[model samples]
Target chain A: MITEGRAWKFGDNIDTDVIIPARYLVTTDTKELGKHCMEGVDAGFSKKVRPGDMIVTGENFGCGSSREHAPMAIKGAGIACVVAESFARIFFRNALNMGLAIFEVPGISGGIQDGDRVSVKHDTGEIIDHTNGRRFFAAPLPPFMQEIIKAGGLMPHVLRKIRG
Target chain B: MGQTITEKILAAHAGRDVVVPGEIINVRIDIALANDITAPIAIELLEAANIPSVFDREKIVLVPDHYVPNKDSRSAEQVQIMRRFARKHDIRYFFELGEMGIEHALLPEQGLVLPGDVVIGADSHTCTYGALGAFATGVGSTDIAAAMITGETWFKVPESIKFTYKGKPQKWVTGKDLILYTIGDIGVAGARYKAMEFDGEAIEALPMADRMTMANMAIEAGAKSGIIAPDQVTVDYVSRRAKRAFELYVSDSDAAYVDSKSYDVSEIEPQVAFPYLPENTRPVSGAGTVPIDQVVIGSCTNGRIDDLRLAARVLKGQTIDRNVRLIVIPATPTVYRQAMAEGLLETFLAAGGIVSPPTCGPCLGGFMGVLGPGERAVATTNRNFVGRMGHPTSEVYLTNPAVAAASAVLGRIGSPEEL
Candidate 1:
């Protein structure tokens, strides 16, 4: 899988409350949550997003809450991909569990800027900053996780496993 | 090589005699939990997967404490989904409003979670059970759905870090202060993806309530779990409430650790975390004279009976300051009844404070005491993140119950020493 989009840069410790506040957690609908994505961090952030846009952030991104709504909100806000310096453990599992594309590349946040065109390759774990002509490699996904993504997320993988 | 307590518990659950850090392994789950906020999503995903039956109805625990008692029509509907699912499956540990508390506190209080158990909840504070020597952590809704169907999940073994506290604590320093100071030392992501094993004489002497408070905030330091090896205190706490036999897993003396830190508790003051981050801490004595609009003393973090007792001790006869709104929530029905019997409820009421029933209402800013724009509060609940208790412009100062109670009476961010 590959995705190319403009980047929205964020600082470290961009927690879940900033992703989608608790008040909006009343629903699980992706689109409903999408409208409020990053509402706390940068108000009207979702409105500025174009389809297939991506987010580039610093360390400990999505640092609080196990609410998958954080990832769901990002995905719903038309973020086709996310690349961060690091991720909180639960958020890393959550974004992938939902089939969202997220990569971790050390120092990528510093090189990238808002609206920088970026592209990512899932199989090769390659991340390219097209505007700056710089490249980085994310830590490769384990085979089982790669399989989960190939199946379009954990739910599909589990569905196939139980149904098969 | 000797194994850490986390390694031993994971190995037992994985059906192995030994396991090493960073190795991915599949393990059986002893308790699979979800609350109203996250359960609705898992329930929806379970329907999408077309799985007709759960792996074990008995092992699945559901609590609707996050936004229960029907916060609104939407939250009401969300909880109904979990309620109906619980009834359809006859899940044994389903807790409704009256019986429910904060899921983390409720599970341990009811003895549903035991030492050496593998517990997973679709809530970040699931790590709270590690206080009882369990290997527990938080997961996402989809993961909870998978566990619901498979009765199992996988984990990458995490490296262990050891923290030891020496000497005795000063007056007004409780588990909240200790954990706050630890977070201050380590920074938010200091223990990311690692197990924090809390030990030493101070820890052994700490009560179960304080122990839970310490473990509950491990997530604040980006740890996968926080644990204390079970001792006589644990045995006594569990034997009274736990109906099933439990296993106690302790770290071998020679266990490996990625890092270790020792602190002299006598030198540590009652710490308070400033707004925006739990890592931003300061000693209470120097916490500038900032007036507060609200003082909340309850949540999964410090809403236990002991916390209420301490707050009541500080607030026995003093009325809450006219400028402050004091909202106290008991964690569970049992705690509420106990407080009533002990007149803690009367004390709070007489002090001009309103006591809420067992609900996680204000902690996550869900309801009950949400801060208005530009308002500030001193809360005993965990996480003073921007907008954690209400408006994004609002600020929350995180402290222990005694400080919270005193601050309520003083109408500012002061400690019990002031009273």
Candidate 2:
């Protein structure tokens, strides 16, 4: 699957604490969560985002806590993919397991500016920044993960696996 | 091949000789835990599972610590749900307010965890027990419920990272700061999918409480758990608190480590995380004086007797700023008693600081210590993310107990030495 969007920039260590504050952890509804996404760090973030927009961040994105709400809120907010220098392990796995597109592009922070358009493929490592006309390499998703992403998250994937 | 502590525990629970990293396997859980905030959701999930009873009622530990004594009607309802669940499931370890502390502290102090066990709790700080040589990790409510019904959960054996501290810390530098420095060096996720083993002279020289603080934040760094080889201090601690004996083992010299790093303890300094995130930390001196509305000296990360004593020492005979509200919470009931015995509570009370019953209260922003819009606090709790303590507009600055106490006196975020 291909996704393209304008970029929303965040610096290093954009933790789950900032992505979705602990106060909103009471609900599991992604839409309710998306409204609060990044509201802690930037109160207007939810209002500024549009469908298919991407987030580009510095190293150590999604650090602190294994709150599943973080990625759910981001994906629910209609972000296409998050390109970061690095990702916290649980967040990385959880994001991938949930089929949320995240690219680990070291030093990619300097390459993109806010409002730049970018494109990504879930299976391929191809990432295209149309605004700057810059291309970056990313690790390719494994075949199994492709299925998981296509199925739309771990729950559906697990359901399919169990049914089979 | 030599097996590390995590590997050994995973193998034992898997009923296999050895388990490799990145491979997922379902293993039997020796214990399952939940605090008041999580127990309700976990119980709901448990009911959804349609299990007549928990796998082993004795294995489930419930504590109403987050908002014990009930912060508000909503919080009280959550506690009541947990209480009912515990009663129906025959969970004998349901701890009430005056009887509770932070779940992590109370578990180890009450002899509930032992070496080489696989334990899971709904609270992220559950990883704290790994300091005692148990392979414990935190999970969500559903996972905890699954464990309650089946006594099993899936885990991907994480790779191991070894950190060695070379020298003694300078005066005023603490294990709390060392953890911050290490997190800075590692960039928050360097130890992802890994178990970090703290070794070398510096960690050995530190007290068990400080070691627990170190192990506690390992999760923040994307580690499976952080552990230090249980030494004489560990043995003494277990002997004093636990009725049964535990066999603690150090990782073999040849144990495999996916990554290894070392630090100079003497170079470490007091660290502070600004209004944004825990990992966005700088040395305390680098951060200019920051205005504060409150100072909190408690949480699973920093609420202990040593932490309280340090804060009390700073507060003794010194009045806090009229604008500042300094709050202290002991990690457990035992720590509260110890502090009371030592006159620390009296000192704090005299200083105009409120001492709350031990719970995750302010840390998870569950009930107590909710910051209002535009309010800023210098807190010893982990994760200073904006709105983490309460209102989305409120800002939390993370620091150690000493700095928190000093900030309370100054009515702003400042280092202890500055005071």
Candidate 3:
């Protein structure tokens, strides 16, 4: 089963730099790191985020450097998942490897808004946005990836598989 | 049913007669790489695996470029670890700063990589080798660890796009402009999970440097890799550098491509990427006025000898605006020595630009060129996203070295046409 969240809208090509600035890369503590999420692009982002918020946006949503810190900071900041029109290749892998929830919703950007509570069923491509009680369709996660998410990131997933 | 250069190579490396798109296959690597910024962590992971030695010591090439000349102890310590690792494992090409340059530049220049081979590097720009008709990609440290231990890794074959070019470039337009134009048309994610193959008479006529500039920036378009089939230019370059002769690969005329685009370069002009992303681009003529505090000219992209020579030609006898501080770093020490011997250093210093050692500094906001809050600078480095070069609010305008040099002279974003 997949967890659901309220929507948090962002614009096109919301790069990794806007998600997490490089200054905070010195530490690996996710909690202390979440405080600075989106601080680079929007200083008010931290206070504005509520638990269970999901980010929705346009293409190349993580288009800059290959720093895994970008996804780590986002997942750490209580973002349930990021459903983008598309994602940069490195960011896509990094997000999955880190076990942060993300989906590719090719045509759903025009159908969503901020503060809209949405329940995403990853296996069925079902999306329930509570604001207008609308249902939107998206690509379902691949079975292999779903298993990885179930185990919570690549490391744990690898450990579980290897040990089993 | 046609095979791409990447597909053909991966199939050959995997010992298969043929491999198709979306099919997974395990292929042996011709080369595995890691630089200073990525090597230490990858080496740490490899050590944890408790392997006695790598699958083959000579197959690994360790180059220290990003933090070369060792600005701080932490970076210096990382270099020391890599050196010890290389020495202990008998790694053949462990290039130090003075002996090394950019890994991408050094790899081909030293003839360590060849066509139709599978190569992996811990750094993303490793895809730069795709220009030589190889199947190359970047992976994480753990993946590199696996490759080190087993000498092979699995990949799902990618579809490819064919980019056909026609027409001669106009005055003052360089390869950087053409690539920026291509990225603009494709946006940032147009080529995800696909390879891009450059073809036709136009791509054929381009110098090797131009082809490399195109392949180097292919990642900015979200492509897994971009390549041009090896032609006379490629063969000559490889032959001159490699002690042993190597074969080249080409895509079939009827090869399948998910998409294709064509360009005529006669209308091209100098290009610049605005304050945030590589895709945030505009022609220099369309790039309107913006003030700046700093200027930079070095990175894996646009940090070669040709880049410096282009800047030097524009700033030969001129002085930069008194307010702007310009920083110029050669891509490799060899490039530095060449620039010095050619007196490019004298021209740069005379024009008020400060020269730093070869490192990927300022490109990642790691060291040397950190931006102050609200201060904007025109740079020749890749990526202008917030905080990419330092403070988030400090804007960066990405341009070729020529435009960067001109902007440094004018104290704001301007064109090299004036110079």
Candidate 4:
């Protein structure tokens, strides 16, 4: 699967509380969560983000708090994918479980800047910076994890297994 | 290859002879925990998957301590849904409001977790049980749903980082300070996807409470889990409360580690994490007089009996600043009862502080003393990310119980020595 989008860059250690504050966790509605995505760190994030936009960040993205809401909000806000130097363990799993594509490419942040046109190939683990004509590679997801992403997250993945 | 303690625990749970980092393996879960906030969504996912019943009701534990006492109609509905599900499924470990406590703190105290077990919870602090020598980690609700249906989950055996502490901690410097200093030394992402295996003479000398405090914040440094090898101290603590016999495991002497570091605690001072990230730490002596609107001394991190005793000792015969509101919350009802029995609660009350029952309270900004806009707080809870305690403009400084109590008295960031 290939995804193309504009990049939105952030610094290192963007915690879950910055992605979605704990106060907005009262509801499980994806839209409600998306509405407040990145409110803590960037007040205009939700309003400015467009569908198919990608998030690029430095290391330890989604570092604090184990709330799955962080990734849910990122996915809900119509982000096509997230490319980070690294991710907190729980956030990495949560993003994939919620059907959001994420990639870890060393120095990926240095290659992309805010609003740069970028394309990602999930199958090949390649990230292309269209604006700067730069190419980078990310570690490909393992087969089983790719299967879950293809099924639109863990719930559906489990459901498919149950049916089979 | 010889295995680290984490690999050993996972190998045992997976029924394998050996395991290695980056290898995916399925393992049976000894315990699956969820609190009110995460359980409702997990229940929905479970129903969506068309799973009629849980794999083992007895292994599932639900605690509704996040917004307990029904903070609002929506929260009340959420808790009610979990309550109904627990009752219908006959999950033996469900704890209602009166018996409810923060899942991380209450689980071990209730003997729901044992040594060498593979545990997962919907909350991040679930890693706290690693102090008991368990391979416990946090997962999302959908993962919990999958675990509920199958009684097992998959894990990529993680690389391990070894932390060795030497000498002794100074007075009023506790595990909270040590862990804070460690996180500061290693950036927030230092141990991503790795086990933080804590060892050393100083670690062995730490009390169970301090161990829990350290383990509780492992997630803050992006660790999969923070673990300590089971020793006589751990044995004494777990055997007295564990309902069943448990196996103890330790790392092999030749176990490989991705990285290792050593610290001398006698040279370390009390530490505090500044706002926005836990890694932004500075010693209390140099933290300057950053005035605070509130001081919270509780949470799964440093909310035990010893934590209360430390705070009470600092607050004895001293009243907190009138401008600052100090909120003390016990992590569990058992801890609360013990504090009350020992007059800790009375001392807090006398010091112009509000003592609350066992609840997560303002730790996650759920309720109970939410800060106003631009307000700053010094708290004993883990995590001080942007807007963690209240409004988006609010800030929180993370510190130990001694610093929190002393800061409350001085109306600024202070230490126990100032008291």
Select the stronger candidate by lDDT from 2 and 3.
2
Model 2, TM vs. native? 0.85
Residue B53 error, candidate 2, Å: 3.7
lDDT of each: 0.93, 0.80, 0.78, 0.89
**Each model: TM-score of chain B?**
0.99, 0.96, 0.96, 0.99
Highest-TM-score candidate: 1
Model 3 lDDT at residue A19: 84
Runs in model 4 lying further than 4 Å from the true structure: none
- Ordered list by DockQ, greatest first: 1, 4, 3, 2
* Pairs of residues clashing in candidate 2: none
Candidate 4 chain B least-lDDT 10 residues? B43-52
lDDT tens digits, residue span B176-195, model 4: 99899999999788888889
Task: Decide which is better by DockQ, 3 or 4.
Answer: 4
TM-score for candidate 4, please give it.
0.98
In candidate 3, list every pair of residues with a backbone clash.
Answer: B276-B385
Cα lDDT tens digits, model 1, B1-419, are 89999999999999999999999999999999999999999999988767789999878999999887778999999999998989888889899889999888899999999999999999999999999999999999999999999999989999999999999999999989999999999999999999999999999989999999999999999999999999999999898898787899999999999999999999999988999999999999989989999999999999999999999999999999999999999999999999999999999999999999888888998998999999999998889888889999999999999999999999999988787
Candidate whose DockQ is highest = 1
- Please give the ranking of all candidate structures by lDDT, highest first, separated by commas: 1, 4, 2, 3
